[model samples]
Target: MQLVVARIGRAHGIKGEVTVEVRTDEPELRLGPGAVLATDPASTGPLTIATGRVHSGKLLLRFEGCLDRTAAEALRNTLLIADVDPEDLPEESDEYYDHQLMDLDVVLADGTEIGRITEISHLASQDLFIVERPDGTELMIPFVEQIVTEIDLEEQRAVINPPPGLIDDSQAEVASERDDA
Candidate 1:
């Protein structure tokens, strides 16, 4: 499988270094120097990483054959893709990649069908699973331990333990009385 690991940002200085917005969790392994990555535009790459550094908390990478600002600027907004094997799983048992979680059937604890995970939206606070329901409507489910209880990769399913009102407003309770006497 091909995973987008980073997006090339603006050129960093006169050198061929370009700032990048990292998309992968394992940057050191994927973005390390001498790592050859495929590019999105196809014609721009496959580019080879000559060097990488962290400057001002941002990752900067210099590609081989790109020796100046102009050359680096040409790669701006280009996506860097990394080749990955389907069987190559994460070392941690509990951890999973976004690609691994995608397309899994979402179900309730008793195996009630909810939806299918279409996208994983990474937010500043928490990740959200964009689920497509059987009725063709989309539902945003919080990807938290309190809600998403289990992930059965072998079965290709995700079991969620949703609280009342989480699945539908009909299951939610509303106030029946007010104290504004």
Candidate 2:
């Protein structure tokens, strides 16, 4: 089983229990005992859940090996993950993980292939996609239903209807100006 859940933030307490910034919608259910958290391929170690409780509406977790303030502090920026069952995910057809969107080809409404998605950034109001074109130009597109019309994950392509002045030929000139500045 592959672990997909990301540890967004840390816990706040004195008992070696850290708050987990859950990536999944169901945080309460997934932070149960015996859940394994793999940090990386080289650091893929199990985090035995000593106890889990909700404090101030956040998931507070205590691992078996971590039993002190220093131990919990060590995990301040660490990520927690567990094996996810694909069937357990939400049935929303439009929803996709950021990892799944990476490397997807971005195309305009007129079938002009713009770029490939390199990253997804979060803004105060919406998510933005960083796309890298073949010409090495990077375009920042707002990821909204209004602009993104279709996402074919199997084909690894995203069809977008960019807003006016977003992808015009003059946009390159603006980019060059910014680079010069």
Candidate 3:
């Protein structure tokens, strides 16, 4: 299994270091020096991490052979992928890998079948579950504790307690009207 560890941002300096937006929880293990990562473009890398450091709360990394600003700039926005065992679980009990949640059936508290989780979007604030409905439409549900009440891994399902207007279009109009008032 290949998991995204980081995405290369702008070139940090002339020394080939580039700022990285980390995607993994274990950056030290996944993005540390000596780790070779596959690239999204599949041409820019297989980049080997020569050095890594945290500057101003951001991760900066220098890859082997990318020894100049121009070389580093060419890697901007490239996703760093690391190979891992498909069955690898996150260290934390409450956390889950994207692969674990994918394709799980999503249901409501009252056993109403909503959809299936097709994708997981990792945002700055929180993760979003992209649930695909039976009709082929999609719903972006925030993967927060308040809305997502349960994750039954053994049952292969997620129970959500979405607030008003989240899934129902009529409820959304009511919510909009209330906000205007």
Candidate 4:
């Protein structure tokens, strides 16, 4: 599958180069000459890299055929993707990709299956796990070491001890009060 690594922001200069907001953790390894990138959900063409360099912490990219400001401007907001082999990804014992965590079963410390992970959000302070219950209710659980005790990626399960006043019943009551108001 192709994973998105960057998005074309704007035309950097008149010479076919565009500024990119990098999404990958290893930007240096991903951007280089002769690299192939696919623009997702918009242009269907596979963009072949003519040149790439980091300028002021952002990636500057020039496509093989794209020349001049007009051609480069046309690619604004295009997501750059590279074909990724799942096996090629590094295995961190505790850390996991957001995509891998999504839709995994979320169980409590005592072995009660409460929900499935629907999304993983990165906040200013920490990561948040959005778990969705069978009844369609969503719980925003903070991904803290104390709360999220264990993550078994091989088993596709996360063991969590939810903080006080964050359970399904308490959250539902809070939602109900908001609705009533």
lDDT of 1 by residue, 47-164 (tens): 9999999999999999999999999999999999999888888889988998899999999999999999999877879889999999999999999999999999999999999877
Q: Least lDDT summed over 10 consecutive residues: which range in candidate 1?
A: 172-181
Give one digit per residue, the lDDT tens place, for model 4 in 14-49.
999999887665666666788887777545468988
The runs of at least 3 residues in candidate 2 whose Cα sits more than 4 Å from the true structure, single-residue gaps closed, are 1-4, 8-11, 25-30, 41-44, 84-89, 122-124, 168-181
Q: Candidate 4: lDDT of 1?
A: 66
Residue 35 of candidate 2: its Cα lDDT? 71
Write the residue-wise lDDT of candidate 2 on 47-92 in tens digits. Answer: 7778887787877888888887777877766666677664453558
TM-score winner, 1 or 4:
1
Residue 108 Cα positional deviation in candidate 1, in Å, after optimal superposition: 1.0
Model 1: clashing residue pairs? none
Q: Estimate each model's TM-score.
A: 0.89, 0.74, 0.88, 0.76
- TM-score winner, 2 or 4: 4
The local distance difference test score of each candidate is 0.92, 0.75, 0.93, 0.82
lDDT of 3 by residue, 134-168 (tens): 89999999999999999999999999998888998
Question: On a 0 to 100 scale, what is the lDDT of residue 114 in model 4?
Answer: 80
Candidate 2 clashes between residue pairs 3 or more apart in a chain or in different chains: 11-18, 11-19
Candidate that scores best on lDDT: 3
Error of 1 at 38 (Å): 0.7
In model 4, which residue pairs have backbone atoms overlapping below 3 Å?
Answer: none
